[model samples]
Structure formats: C-alpha cells, structure tokens
Target: MLTSAWLDGLSLGDPIAADPLEGGYASRTFRVRTALGGSVVVKTQDNLPENLYALEADGLDALRAPGGFAVPEVLRVTPSYIVLSDLGTSEPSPTYREDAGRALALQHQQTADKFGYHVDNYLGTLPQRNPWTGDGHTFFAEHRLLRYLEEPNCHNQLPADDRRRLERIAGNLVNLVPVQPPSLLHGDLWHGNLLPAPNGGPAMIDPAVHYGWPEADLATLLIYGRLSDTFFDAYEEVHPPSPGWRARLPLLHLRELLCITAHWPDRAETVQEIHTILEQFD
Candidate 1:
C-alpha cells in the first residue's frame, strides 16, 4: 500500500491519491496524484534484478533520445521503484495509429554501426543479451534466437528434436533475413506498450530497446493483430520495408514466442507456435 509518508520520503510531495493501474503482470503500478495536483505513474517490484529499474530508465532515455516517440518522463528511480510523468492513455484512434507508425519509422532511421546495444537489457523480467557485433545474422542467431535455448524453462518445454530444428533455423538466418543496418528498435512494441496520449498522439512505454533488425519490431506488432493497415501505410511513407518483409513475420516472431516459452513453461500453445515456425524455416 502507498502512503503520503512514502511519497514524502521520495520528495515527490504528499500524495492526495493513488489509483491502481491494470496490465501489470510483473510489477505493481499506480497513478499517483500529489497535493500539488501533479500525477505520475509509479511502478514497483519487491524482488527484481539489481539494476532492472535503472536499465529501464536507460531504455526510456534511449527511446526519447531519438525524438521519435512520446515516452514517459522518468521522474525518479530506485532499485524497487520508478516514478514517471503520466502520459495518460485513451482508446486509440486511426489517426493516432498513423502517427505512431510514422514516429516509429522515423525512430528506426536513427541507425547504429553495429547490431546490439552498449549493454544488455531486459525483455520483461528476462535478461536480453546484446553483445555488439558487425554481422546482423550472427548477432540475431546467437543472441536473439539460440541464447534462450539455454534457459531452464526452454530445456524443459522443448524436446530434443525441436531444439535441433531451432539450431538449423538460426544457422540459416543469413539466407533467410535480408541485410539491414542496425536500426534502433523499441524492442518490445506490441499493442499493450503503445498508448494514445492525451494530446492525441502515440505514446510508448515498457521498451526493451536495442539496435537490431527493424523487422523484429514490426513483426511484434503484426503478430499481436492489434495494429491496422493505416499504421503500416503511414510507416511505409516514412521508411519503406524491405522486399519480402511480410513473408518474414513468422521467422522474426520466433524471438517473442521463444521468450514466452521461457517465461511460462506450461504454455504448450507457445511451444507449438515455435514448432510451426521451425517447420517453416528449419
């Protein structure tokens, strides 16, 4: 429970109210209102990796760095908690989706020399390793795809034959995926992370940011069936996708499916989805 005293300790001021927010599977989130009439979103986790919030703050900074998307302002951060200026969410309009698409494409235009981040970051509670590498294929295969196989949950969920198939697919990334510069990705740009800002533009939250193949972000949005053609059309107006990009959705989506399996070993459906992708590429 949050109290005014706690807010005082953080020097945020006396909170007149704290309202719980939904869709927080990994942490407790609240929209806190202070006596000063300022509202901020507070996210807290009792047990987390030592630097999770700090890393998250870094990611938010990276996203904001590109000046492409509207991300929350990181007002304060501690090991267990983070306070961000509330961007405020609403039901998204078609115009908002289009704006989001354009913003994302423009964001990806800011590329890096290599395919990775300066340091590793998290995808949800899971660690995402990002060792800087020149070859995109090697980076995606080793870091994004195969590395999760070492997770204990994956070992339990995937059979030996399925594991071998995944290896073959990873080995063939060079032949499958088109070469693209290391574009900055929101890294986790699904519908849930995209919000309609009060000013009627797209605001993003909960990023797993890195420099990677831009298709990975598009695939994440398409796989969830939340984004519409308006978004893609607007995106293409800014930055056109590579040829055969649509055909690569299943392949790019393997990263998210594998992560899901690692997070929830009991989710047989996610495992089956992995098998489907492997059968297509392996």
Candidate 2:
C-alpha cells in the first residue's frame, strides 16, 4: 500500500482498492476508494524544483472561483501527493466535446493581465523552459520548439526534407502575428486531460497551467484525436479563433510534439505523426 503523509487530516477509512488510471505521462495516478464510500484521485511525483502539485492547486482554485469554469475541487496538495475530487469514471461526454469550444471561451474569459505566469512550471516532469523575457515568438519557437528539435532524438526522427521544412516553418512563425495579451490558459488542454463531471459539465485536470495565447489551448486540442467537431462549432459560437488561426496550428503543436519526442523517444508512432503533420505544412 502506498502511504500518503498528507492524508492525516482527512478520514480515509478502510482501503478498498487502488486502480491505475490512464493518460498521465508524468505523474502516477490512482483511483483510491474507501470503505466509507469516499473516493478520490491521487497523484504522486518526485520532488522537483517546481512544486507542481501546489501550482496545480492554485490553478484549480483560480479556475473554480466566481465566474471561472467548472474545475475539479482540490482536496490536498503536498510535495509528494495531491488528492482531488473524483469527477467520475466515465470518459468525457460528447457534450463536453461539443461544448468544449464554448467552455474554453468561458474559461479564457477568466484572464490575467500578464503575458507570463509569475512562477515557472513544468510540462510533464520536464522543464518547460518558458522565456522570462516575455517574447512569445522567441519563447514558443526559438527557445522551446527549435531548441527541442536540435536534440538528437528529434533530429534522427526527421528526414532532411522534413527538417528543412520545419526550419522554414519555425522561421515563418516568428513573424506571423504580434503576441496577443495573455489569458489564463489550461496550458496543456489536450483531450485526455479533460474529464466529464457527473452533472454533465466539463472538468479539467493535469494542466500545464500558464498565462498565454488562448489559441495555444485550441492548438493543443487539435493535435490529439479526442476532440469532436462539435467542440469547434461550440467554441466558435462563443469566442472565434483569430484570423489565420488554422495556419498557426502546426506551429503551436510543434512545441508540444517536440516536447513529447524529447521525453518519449521510444514512441516511433509519435515521431511518425509529427513527420506527417509537418509534411502537410510543407
């Protein structure tokens, strides 16, 4: 049995079972049940310079405040563990997918003034290396995506043509648009990180929380195959993607794909997918 020193305040009751939940790449997650009918999701990780659980707790609290989106209620957060409300066992509903766009608009409406967060955070256990200089293009392209591609893991995966194409795209992205005022973003809003609440609303978790362009969230959602078309429809109804947003998708996704490739070099399928997507832009 795994011990959580942070659970001292709450009555955990008799242990039922600790079943593994899928989709977290960095932290260990389990569905913990108690004999007294209480259940919660627990996430554990090694202590790092960034107290991610605490940051997540703060982010969730911000998102649950007045006029914020429906986010999970945080139960406890410590250096090694975080306990959170169990939204449920069910997968995200079509309603979630259908309404995701609108929901995101609502979430984005909850914004902050700064373009960057005060404290730096990680992306899946890896140092995200966001620029403190506050230059969005330089941060997104030069420091994040291009720097990751220079890694041997990414270099070996791309053919010469694809590398050239990626380089050109990266250069082009620098001048695409002036950075918009930063909004509070879920940071890593991929489909798997979102779950359905029992009451038919959407709940978010495992966020790489930050303040950045709203389009960054939309771009990440399009990379995975989970979001439904209804999501886009609903989103546009509330907050439409900016002009040339479609063209910028690959540029935004390049950072995420490179991050994954750097961390999970063995995932040849992911590398192949990156190649395929890059080919489309070329």
Candidate 3:
C-alpha cells in the first residue's frame, strides 16, 4: 500500500498490483490495480521539469478529442508522477486499427491559428520549442528540423554537406512540401505510442503534441513501421495527404533522427538511420 499524498487523494485503497510498464528508457510506467474495483496507470520521471506531467495531461486531453481513438483518462498529474485510467493491454483488432486511422485523420481536422503549441514541451528527454508561427514551411523547417542543430550533439555531429542539404531542403520547403493549415498533431505518433483499449478501439499514448502540418504526423507514423496497409488506406481515405508524401517521409523523419541523436549521441542505430536519410539529401 503506497501512501503518497497523491495516491491518498485517489482514495482507491491499496493497489492489488502495481507493475512497471517497461519499454523505453526515458520514463517509468506502471499498471496499478486496486482491490476494490478498476485499475489505473502511473508514470514517473526523475529530475523532470515541474510541468512535465501537467503538459502530458494537457496533451492527452487534446488528443482525446473526437478522433477515431481513445486516450487513457488523466486521473491526476503531479510534478513527478501522472496517474491515468487504465486502457488495458489488448492489441487493436484490424477494424480497430482502421478506426484508429480514421480517428487520427479526423483529429488532424482540428486546426490551429499557427504552427506551434501554447508552450514548449519534451520529446523523450529532448526539449521541443513551439513558438507559434504563421508559415507552415518555416515552422517545420526551423522549429521542427533546424532547431535540433543547436543541440550539443546535433551541432557538430551532422555533416557539413548534409547540413547544407538540410538548408537546401529548408529553403525549398514551400516547393517540396504542401502548404496547409496547422492541424493538431500528435507530434510523435509512431507504433510504440499506440495501443488498443479494453472497452473498444485504439488509443495512443506518449504524445509529443503540437499544432503543425498533419503530414508531420504521417511522416512519424511509419518510422519503425509495423502498421498494416489498412491503416494508411483508412487514413488517406479520411484525409488524403499531399501528393508526394511518400517521397517526403525520409525528409520529414530527419527531425526525429536528429532529436534522437541530439539526446543520445551514442545510439548507433539512430545514428545510422540519420546517415541513411542524409544520404538522400547528399
């Protein structure tokens, strides 16, 4: 029976079980079951920003809006810990995956006045800058991509030729990518962050949320790809992307790769992935 004040606030009595939700190296996640009734999820981070869980709770609320998916409910948010309603461990059914894709497209329909968020937040451990901007291309190019260049690792690690190519890509963004309204985005919408809910359809977790071109979400969806074609088919039918989005994925993915390298320069797999994408620019 953990007796932290926040847990006491829940008044759910002692948890029957509280298992670590292990996977990523960044945060400690737990699945807590109460003897009286239902379960909840808890996550914590060390040396965290005071608003970290608060920001996450905000993003969860934002994503839970009428999208074709579910987000675990926010039970409570403390400086170090966030308690969420348990969503269970079920993998999405094929139909649920399709629904998830449709829901995501619908979610993207929700737009913003500019290309950023009201506040800065985190992507894993790396800081994300989200100052609002009117230009989508500049927003993606500068805040999403180029900003990582200033990081301690990213600055010197990215090669000069590739850096120039990034400059070229940024300069030619208007020509290369679609100009569109800033759609609400789950800024990091890869497979790892998505899950199936017990009650019904799919739900997403661990968002790096912002308001930006929806293609940014598409670009991220396939990064460590495992989603079926049905997912994309459903997504495109609901919200067809810019004509050459496939060609643009490698370009869009540069942001994440750079972010990963910026945060953990020693991750060889990520470093290799960065090189692979940069070769296209070279």
Which 10 consecutive positions of candidate 3 have the poorest summed lDDT?
1-10
Candidate 1 worst ten-residue window by lDDT: 3-12
Full ranking by lDDT: 1, 3, 2
The clash count for each model shown is 0, 1, 1
Which residue pairs in candidate 3 collide? 68-103
lDDT by residue for model 1 (1-282), tens: 675543656566688888999874567999998877778898988888878889989999998854377899888888888888898766666588788989999999989999999999898789999999999999999999999999989999998999999999899999999999899999988888988777778888998989999999999999988788999999999999988998998899999998888887697889999998899888
TM-score of 3: 0.93
User: lDDT for model 1, on a 0 to 1 scale?
Assistant: 0.87
Where does candidate 3 stray beyond 4 Å? 1-6
Predict model 3's lDDT versus the native.
0.81
Q: After superposition, how far is residue 162 of candidate 3 from its true place, in Å?
A: 2.6
Q: Count clashing pairs, candidate 2.
A: 1
Candidate of highest lDDT = 1
Residue 158 lDDT, candidate 2, scale 0-100: 63
What lDDT does the true structure give each of the candidates? 0.87, 0.72, 0.81
lDDT of 3 by residue, 100-219 (tens): 789889999899999899889888777788999999999988998888878878766777776777777778888777787899989888787888888568888888889998877887
| Model 2: per-residue Cα lDDT over 1-282, one tens digit each | 456454556786754777788888768888888777878888886755447788878767756644335677788888878888888866555566665567778777766655566666778776655445455665566655677767777777767887777777677765664466566788888888777777666777877767677788888898675767888888888877677886777667777887888776586887777787777765
